[model samples]
Structures are given as structure tokens and as C-alpha cells.
Target: MTSVDQPPAFSDGAAVIELLNTSIGYGARAVVDDVSLRIDRGEVVALVGPNGSGKTTIVRGLLGLAPVVGGEVRLFGVPAGRFHERWRIGYVPQRHTVVGAVPSTVQEVVASGRLARRRWWKPPTAADRAVVSRAIDVVGLVDQSRASVSTLSGGQQRRVLIARALAADPEVLVMDEPTAGVDVASAEALTRTLARLVEDGRTLLIVTHDVAPLAPILTRVVAVAGGSVVGDEPARIALSPASALAGGIYAHPGHDPHHLAPDDPAGPAPGPGWLGDPGLRGAPAAS
Candidate 1:
């Protein structure tokens, strides 16, 4: 328990996760279209875009949760659909999954991540317990281990879900909206925990509308729009997380202008230039 486990084997120059010429969707609907992306080992890549932009669908394609209508997906050099090593990848789904009225405890929920490695009918081993305990400690939830998940706040429950993913001893973590709806304190806690994970050499692919809290540790940013990868580049620029969030890093810059008319019900809603106005870019005002 004192040392992190070694990363799984991968071929030279091979990406930890890859989607090549892929299209993913539900029945008769291709939500993510013709996307090609790669995440190398130990890289923290943020997938940012507007709602219905297929960011989550791309992740689902990687996890084999969505239908891959075309092309290929690979994890650690193995085809995603054929990859059997589930524990090598950890996933924290959107918050709604944990908000349900379930009677499970934090510890029990976290421990369930170990189920993939444990035998169907056998009980958890000493190693499983050690890892679960370590995971709880990693997320700063040792004191709340036994607390019922339903009793916890939305943010606390989110931390519990993170601990659950860590309990699997994964080399790559895929998360959707890690800080959405979370309070300031919980968001800070999550940021610190994620930084520690990156230091520990774990890779992360997070789909988020705001990367403000994660700016310090982020290595790259991948922008998805119209169900496609619009931007994929290094995030090593001078922009701080807060500034990036403010500077339209997550804004749907390509949104149609006609949709922002004054009388349109879908027009400029609120909160940080929801209307995608050009003035939001901090341009010089006309004389």
C-alpha cells in the first residue's frame, strides 16, 4: 500500500488511449463523428466544449459504453472492445449517477471498484482492503468512510466516486465534469487530489466545461464541437485556469450568430457570455 503499482505495459510510442477515425452514437444517430484523438501516458487532457458537443460521447466510445459505428478504439495498444483488463482504466461518470437514493455507504461504494479483480463469490482480500483504504485516504475521505452516500452532499459524494475509481488501481482515469455543481471547498479538494494523482504518474482525460481549478496540472486541452475534435494542442501557455475559463476556452466559439438574436428564447441566457457574443472576447469597442 505504500507504493503505487507499476503502469501496465504498452508498446513504444503507443498512446494510452486512442480513437482513430471514429464515429460513435446511439441507434441511427452519430453523436460523435469522424474523430481521431490520442492521449499519451501520464498526460492530463481536458475535453472542453458546449453542451451537446459530443465530448462525453467520445469518452463513452473509449470506454466501450457507446456504440462505435465506424473505425477503431484502442486502450494501451489493445482494441477497446477486446481489451479485457478493466482495472487498468478507471471511470467517474457524471454526478447524476451518484445522486440517486441508494443506501450504500462510502466505503462499500468505493470497495466495489475492486470487484473486477475479485472473484465473483469470494470476499475481498487483504490487498483489496488495503487498496480501498488507500483510495479513501487519497480523496481525504477516511473520516467519512462509513457514512451513507445518500447523506453526503453532492460534492462529497463526488469525492467518494473518485475514491471508488482509485480503488481499482487504474493507470488512466476518465472523468466527466469533475467540478460541475461542486462547492468551492470540494472543488479545491478535488483539484489537490487530482494534482497528486498526476504526480503519481496516473493519466487523466476529463470532459469539462471549466478547467479553472485544473489549469496548473493540465498538460493539454482538446476542444470538441459539433461532434468533432475542433482543437487539440498544448495547454502550456500563460493562461491560468481562471483566465482560460474566462477567455472562452470552453465557449462554443463557432455557435451560429443568428441563434443569439435579442428576442430568441434560446438567446443570450446568462453566466459568462452564454450567448457567445464577440464582445466576450475582450475586443476593443467601436469608437
Candidate 2:
């Protein structure tokens, strides 16, 4: 197992997210303790472990949804607690969290991602609409742009949530269990869409239990168990049964070890850039 005691060397670029010996949980209890992790610009990272392993809690801590009882969490070089340019990071919650009983068009739901970039008193501009449209297209939902989110399949709805995050055009995207509970076909489709995003040079931090489908696009995998990271290694090693067993993470039956190799012709290319504007950075938050 790769040791987490020392920081890994990364390419020259600012870390998009950093957790320094951080402990996070709700109220007074700390779920994960003394965790130090960093995701540099352009890296596609996966936080993998069994359910309740504190992977989700770590993500929550980064988003400030969970209370940080120890250490620090930073976003784009600024302490997360003090960071105001939140528009720089897009988040996609689980699929179930996105759709509700209320009927809403795919376009409407995606456009909402721009809320952090638009002033409340002002309406969405042409550029905003264009960005939303591009996001929808990126997720291959152009035909369903006008379709109600409730009417779509679980996977399509998941794509909607992803499009919603992309609509914000954030530099770094953090997604939780993107392929969870989806049918095989839908999961494959989602993987292809993610491949496109990777090609566009989007920095992604994904939390997932099933990493086989996404193994191709993953650059690194950090295994968390018992509220602490047990293994950190390149995707090639991390996804193997030996490495997984070493970290106490179960390798689900039927997952081919060969797919764990990060050699997908459809995988992400080099560098950090946005979906629409490749050169943009540090986007201002909505007033």
C-alpha cells in the first residue's frame, strides 16, 4: 500500500483542493481524522471505499457541509471557510438528491447551476444561456433539454445533475457516487460523457464505491477505510485486487483487473481547462 505519511509529488500547478491533517464530522463527533490529501489542477482522482468509510464525509468537509473539528481545508489556495469564489468549484450530488416530485425541465434544472454566478436582482444573460446550453449538450441531453427531469431515467437524471454542475463552468468538479444505482447501459453512457469531459481537461474529484467503470479515466485512487486513508496509489495499482485487499477495500466480483489500467484511448488528455472557456480561471462568485 502506498503510504499517506508523505505528500505525493504533483505537476507544477496550484492544488485545486487541499486537506491538511483534517478531521471532519457532524456536530461534535469526528468521522474522519487527521486526513491530508491534495488534488492538483487537471488530475482526475477517485476516493474509493466501502459505504460509511468516510469518503463522502471527506467530500462534505471540502464543501463545508460537514464541520471541520481539526486542521484546515483549502480551495484554490484560500481557506475553504473564507473562500468566497465558490463558483470556481462545481458539485454534483447523488442522483436521488437532484430530482423531486416537482416537474422541471432539464434546461431549467441545468440553468439553476448558474445561480452562484448571477446576481439575484439581474436575469440570466445570453452568455449564461449559452453556457447552460453547452453544458446540456456536453452531457448529450440536447434532445431532453425541454423534457421534464422527473420523466427521465435514473441515469439521465444523473446526467442532468452533472450538466447542472457543468453549467456553472467551474474549474474543479466534485461528484459523489455518479454511477451508483444506475443500469449497466446508463452507466456506460455516463462513462462516455465523462470521457468527453476528461478530454476537455476538467479537474474531477469523484467519490465512488464501484470504480471499475471509471477506472480508465482515473489518474489516482485514494482508498479510505475506518475514517482514514489506507492506500494511495496510481490507478493501475490501486484498482488491483492485491492493492484493494491491502487497503481493506473489497474488489467486487466480476470486475476485470485489466480494465483497472489507466490506458483508455477515451481517457482524459493533459492540462487544466474549462468546458467552455479553456483559459478562464478564478471565476467570481455571485453577489
Q: Give per-residue CA lDDT, model 1, range 1-287, as digits (tens).
A: 00012222231244788787899999989999988887878888889888899999999888888999988888888998789997889999987446546698889999988888888999888999999998988886777788888887777788888888999999999998887776434555576678789888899999877655565567777778799877655655413334343244535532343321223454333334332333212212110
124-232, model 2: which lDDT tens digit per residue?
A: 9999999999898877778778988888767778888998999889988899989777654455556666777777778889998767667657778888888888777
TM-score of each: 0.79, 0.83
Displacement of the residue 141 alpha carbon in candidate 1, Å: 0.8
Give candidate 1's error at residue 152 in angstroms: 0.8
The positional error of residue 104 in candidate 1, measured at the CA in angstroms, is 1.7
Q: Model 1 segments beyond 4 Å from truth?
A: 1-12, 96-102, 238-250, 253-287
Compared with the true structure, the alpha-carbon lDDT of candidate 2 equals: 0.75
Name every residue pair that clashes in candidate 1: none
Q: How accurate is candidate 1 locally (lDDT)?
A: 0.73
Task: Report the poorest 10 consecutive residues by lDDT, candidate 2.
Answer: 278-287
